[model samples]
Target: MNSDFLKYQAQTTPHPLAMEISYANGSYIYDSNNKAYLDFVAGISATPLGHNHPKVISAIKKQLDKYMHVMVYGEYIQKPAVELTKLLAKNLPSSLEKTYLVNSGTEAIEGALKLAKRATGRSEVISANKAYHGNTMGSMSIMGFEERKQAFRPLLPNVKFISFNNESDLKHITKKTACVILETIQGGAGFIVPSNNYLQKVQKRCNEVGALFILDEIQPGIGRTGKLFGFENYNCIPDILVTGKGLGGGMPIGAFTASSKLMDLLQDNPKLGHITTFGGHPVIAASALATLKEVTESNLMQEALEKEQLFRKLLVHPLITEIRGKGLMLAIITPSSDTANSLILKCQEAGLILFWLLFEPKAVRITPPLTISNDEIIKGCEIIIDLLDEIQQQ
Candidate 1:
């Protein structure tokens, strides 16, 4: 199977962590040989509820019994999609009352960009440096890291970048800007959190310039950052809020939300401005609804903060320079890129899963599931600390 996987599957990287899994439950994924590995990355922050969560699985089963993809998004009123959007609206700020569901975060990003252009009648978009929206052309075009995007040049034009958390950069946003997009908590840029009213000042500037402020909460949303959305912690409410990753609970989904007044613009002026055949498929929506319900209704959000404290308390060593980010959305910065790589690969071999940030080679991602228990947190941190200790000894 491993050989077949490599032979048939087109991979994103030359070497993949080809773990042939049998099954996963709670916080552990078992290999084909039944070797259990503690899950620390939560499927890259997409499985906030952990592996094969009962509530999410049960919701999928129930939805499967009813129906699957009956129609494309926005064409038919599907119950799962409608309920999911309504619940999201109830949890979100009043202005963000309408949602357009898509298949992935990048797709939602594309849709949001389109909405911004349509609503404002402008095409210029301002993004943050080191920002990562997605792999799609529109999302990629706004990406700040030019090295990866250089191959995909001639992307969406009129997109410019500014240094994140730099207040003076607000001058770059003017009336001609259609929208200014930013990751509420910059994910790929080493989990950098907005500092010193940076987000608020950006929003204020956008307001003054008549530009729509869009927050890409793809990695920081769905209660991963101790709030329903990361922007809630930063005191900045975006004109358009984009979310995905952990929102689907394990299924594939993405959505962008705005006020009904702003969202309704897509309906007319050209009818069907953005369309997806399976954006809000019933099964995925059911899983997402169940996940969102569990996240908000339970103590998981608060637990995320408490767990973060536990991680900080335990993960201390000479080789570990600093920990960046808030709540579960965190990155441990090592003294060197080699140390970071050694810790990740070594930990995986020791039955602990770890990952790296997209652009920060010296940073190790620690975005575990919100449902991960105290025991799990302590165990994972201990492993990380032990590895760092070993690295220090060497």
Candidate 2:
């Protein structure tokens, strides 16, 4: 199977953590050898309720029995899609009432960019440095890191970048700007959290310049940040809210929400401005709806904060420099990039799953499932600390 995977399948990276999985449940995944590996990455924050969650699976099964994709999004009134959007609106701020569902977070970013351009009649777009929005052409154009995006040049035009959390860079967002998109908490940049009301200040600047403020909550939203949306924690609301990852409960989905008046712009004038065949697929929508219900109704959001405390309290070592981020969205910053890489690989070998952030080579990702037990937290942290101790001795 490993040989076949290397030969037949295209891979994003040369060295993939090719774990032949037998099955996964709760906070643990069983490999082909029946080795129980404690899950701390949660499929890179895609499975908030954990793998094969009963409610998400039941929702998917029930929807499959009823129907799947009926028609393109917005054309058919599918119950799952409708209920999911309605519930999302109920939870979100009033300005962000209407949602346009799509496939993957990049697509949502694309749609939000289009809407901002359509509404503001501007072409300039601004993003933060060291930000990772997505891989699509438009999203990549705004990606702050030039090294990763240099290969895919000739991207969208008039896109600019500013230093994140740098108040002086707000001068770049002029009246010609269409939108300024930022992650509620910069994920790939070592789980960096906004400080000194930076997000609120950005919102104020965008408002003053008539450019839309867009927040990409793909990694930090969906009850992972002790709030339904990370923006809630910062005391600022964006004109456009983009979410994915955990929102689908391990299923593939993405959504962009804005005011009804703003989203309505995609309806007429141009007519069918943005269309997707499987954006609101019934089966996926059912899973997302169930996930939303569980996250909102259950005490998982509050537990995320408590779990974060547990992780911080337990994961104490000399090699560990600091832990960045809040709630379940966290990154353990080691002294060096080599140390971070060693820690992740060693912990995985020791029956614990740990991963790395994209741009921040010195930061080890620890985004576990929200449903992880305290015992699981202690066990995982022990493995990490033990591995760190071993590395320190070397």
Candidate 3:
């Protein structure tokens, strides 16, 4: 099976972990050998409520009994899709009353980019340095890292990048810019949290130039940040809001939301300007609705902050430089890439699941599930600290 996977499966990386999974529950994943590994990575922060969450599974089951993928998006008014959109509208800021759901985060980004250009009647898109939106062409086009995107030349033109927290760089968002896109918390760029006054200044600059501000809350949305969205902490609202990652619990989904007046632009310019076949999938929508309800109504959202405090308190060592990010979206920065890599591999080998950020090799990701218990948090942090100590001794 491993050989078949290696031979047949398209290789994204030269080497893969090749860990065979049996199943997962809560914060743990069982391997084919029945070894339980503490999953701190949480499927790259996709599984918000954790593996096989009861609420999510029950929702999927209930939806399956009723129906699944009944029709293409925007054609038939599926109850789950309608209810999910309505729920989003009720929770979102009044301006962001409409949503365009999609199959994944990248698709939502593509849709949002199109909507931004069409809504503002501009072509130029600006992103931050070291930012990562997704892998699709439109999202990849706005990616600020050149090394990763060097091969895919001649991408969408007029996409520029500015220093994320540098106030002076705000000037680049001039009149011709269609939208200024930013991750509310820069995920792949070492999970760097935006400094105070940075987002506000950017928003103000966008207002000055009539450019739309699109916040990518893909990684930090759905109560991961102790807020419904990361922007809530920054004291500002974006013209466009993109969400995915944790929204579906363990299901796949993404969406971009905006004001009804603004979102309506996508309808007229091309009639069916941006459309999808499975964007508003019923089963996925049901799962997302259930996930959102749990995050909002239950104690999970408030516990994120408390769990974050626990993680920070326990992860300390001489090899550690600093910890970046808010709530559970943490990145433990080491002194060098070697130490970080060694610590991560050792942690994994010792029955823990840790991961690396895409560009920042010196930081280890610790984004566990929002449902992880206090004891689980302590256990994971202790494992990290233990690995750090062993690495230092070497």
Candidate 4:
């Protein structure tokens, strides 16, 4: 299987963690060899309820029995999609009452960017430095990191960048700018959280310039950051809120929400501005709706904070310089990139899953499932700490 994967599959990174999985249950992922690997990263923060969650699976199964893909998104009034969007609207602010569902986070971002341009009638888009929105062309254009995006040059035009958490950079957003897109808590950049009311200040600047403020909550939203959305924690309500990871209960889904007035713009002037055939597939919507319900209604959101505290308490070590970000969205910063790489690979062999951020080579990602137990948290942290000790002794 590994050989076939290497031969047939198009490679993204040269070195892939080729752990052939048999199945997963809760916070445990079983390899083809039947070895249980503790899930510490939760499929890169995509599986909020962990693997094979009963409610999510049941919802998917139920939806499958009823129906699957009916028609393109926004054409058919699918119950699952309607209910999911309604629930989202009820939870979000009154201004954000409409949602455009899509296949992945990148697609959601693309749609948001288009909507922003259409609504504001401007072309300039500003993104934060070291931000990772998605991999699509428009998303790639706004990506602050140049090294990875250099090869895919000639992306969208008139896109600019600002230093995240730096209030002084807010001045760059002018009336000519369509939108300022930022992650509520910047992911892939060492899980950098917004500080000193940075998000609020950005929104203020966007408002002053009549530019839309779009918040990419793909990594930090969906109850991962204590609040249902990370922007809520910072008191920054964006014009467009994009979400994806963990919203689908292990399925693929993404959505961008905006006010009815702004979202309506996508429909007119170009009858079908943005269309997706499988955006709101019934099975996916059912799974996502169930995930959202569980995250909001159950104690999982609150438990995330408790588990975060446990992680911080147990991850104490000389090698671990600092734990960045909040709630389940966290990054353990090591003293060196080599130390971070060694810990991630060694922890995998030690039966604990760990990952790295995109640009921050010295930061180890620790965004486990929100449903991960305290015992699981302690065990994973112990493995990490023991490995650090071994590395230090060497």
The sequence of per-residue lDDT tens digits that candidate 4 reaches over residues 35-139 is 999998998899999999999999999999998887878887899999999999999999999999999999999999999999988999999899999999989
Can you list the residue pairs that collide in candidate 2? none
Each model's lDDT: 0.94, 0.94, 0.91, 0.93
Residue range 1-52, candidate 2, lDDT tens digits: 9999899999999999999999999999999999999999999999999988
Candidate 3 pairs with clashing backbones: none
Give stretches of model 4 more than 4 Å off.
none
Candidate 1 residues 303-365, lDDT tens each?
Answer: 899999988888888888999999999899998999999999999988999999999999999
Off by over 4 Å in 1: none
User: Where in model 3 is the C-alpha error above 4 Å?
Assistant: none
Runs with alpha carbons beyond 4 Å of true place in candidate 2: none
TM-score of 4: 0.99
Worst ten-residue run, lDDT, model 1?
Answer: 383-392
lDDT ranking of the models: 2, 1, 4, 3
lDDT score of residue 212 within candidate 1: 99
Error of 4 at 357 (Å): 0.4
